[model samples]
Target chain A: DAGVTQSPTHLIKTRGQQVTLRCSPKSGHDTVSWYQQALGQGPQFIFQYYEEEERQRGNFPDRFSGHQFPNYSSELNVNALLLGDSALYLCASRLVGASTYNEQFFGPGTRLTVL
Target chain B: SQQGEEDPQALSIQEGENATMNCSYKTSINNLQWYRQNSGRGLVHLILIRSNEREKHSGRLRVTLDTSKKSSSLLITASRAADTASYFCATGGTGKLIFGQGTTLQVKP
Candidate 1:
């Protein structure tokens, strides 16, 4: 089965520009979560989407938002990005059914370079 | 706030040896998971131990969780050069998973 798939493997954007990343959850998964990994640091939780609604978010600012569609795909949007926004964006999916557990599967991630 | 913090910012070991990394958390959790990442890439899930459980083993990996102490340890036996990567501990706080700084492991063949 396909784990999790993310779009735009790499991107280049100027300051103050906006970027959108896409993710498709694994088969049978319903919950999608986003994370940002800075250089030499562990991944930080950005937000989580389930049932087409954002259920949890980290301490990040308002610039970061996400959406989950009915098909279990997710979109992560970053607005007015700054140079500090250069990092790797990762998407993770977890099953939410009777066979679901707390285990999470991650995608290859989108590398964003904000200059 | 983050819940988990791993010890020994970095570790270096020889092949065929065992490597142990420890992590400490600040709150109660449903489960604690261990993941490995190579060069800031995607994380590969290694193992997960529930709060009610004390220890678990999977292949060459072993995980131990102590709810009272709020800490966990990941032990990798017979390490190989390919095992060189950063290890992170994630604690499930309700619906969110909080991560730690992680430990960088370098195994030499």
Candidate 2:
């Protein structure tokens, strides 16, 4: 009955460095999606993973990548990060093909600070 | 690019008052969902209205969707200080969600 969970509540990195944030989806969920929310803005879709494959992606660049593990957990990796990359990284998960209207459960975001 | 935009970027009202937030989207969606975030944290799902549905209610929250206008509005009735949060509307289509810049609502006690 646990909800979505994320690790590294806070991270500090410099420009050009790489950082990885992890997320464990809620029980009985198989799809994971990542989002980035900058200050004073809504979350921008990053990518979505299902069945261990990326099913959809947003307008993000190649530097932003993600992986879905067999257990339905997910990891968002940002490479060569810039100061602008500093934001709250959010993870949401849902059971694909569920009868419901694709309602996603979100986890407490990981605060990333890129200096 | 964000698909939805919320109106009155910020709103302040006293407790026992009602708070309304509107969202307009640019594209068609299968469902529209409203989420509440407190202080940049995780978003809590408020309600989801399907494309076919016009209005839905959950507790003190009432959501109205006007598909023809591509807009949705969330009404929080008799608001309490605990209702203070940033409200975001997300459009769901193609399995991915496109979010709007949230409306910050402050319900004063």
Candidate 1: give the clashing pairs: none
Q: For residues B1-109, could you state the per-residue lDDT of candidate 2 as single tens digits?
A: 9887899899999999999999999988889999999999999999999999999999999999999999999999999999999999998765578899999999999
lDDT of 2 by residue, A50-74 (tens): 9999999999999999999999999
User: Which DockQ-derived CAPRI band holds candidate 2?
Assistant: medium
**TM-score value, chain A, candidate 2:** 0.98
lDDT of 2 at A12: 99
Residue B8 lDDT in candidate 1: 86
**TM-score of chain B taken alone, every candidate:** 0.95, 0.97
lDDT of 1 at B77: 98
lDDT of each: 0.89, 0.94
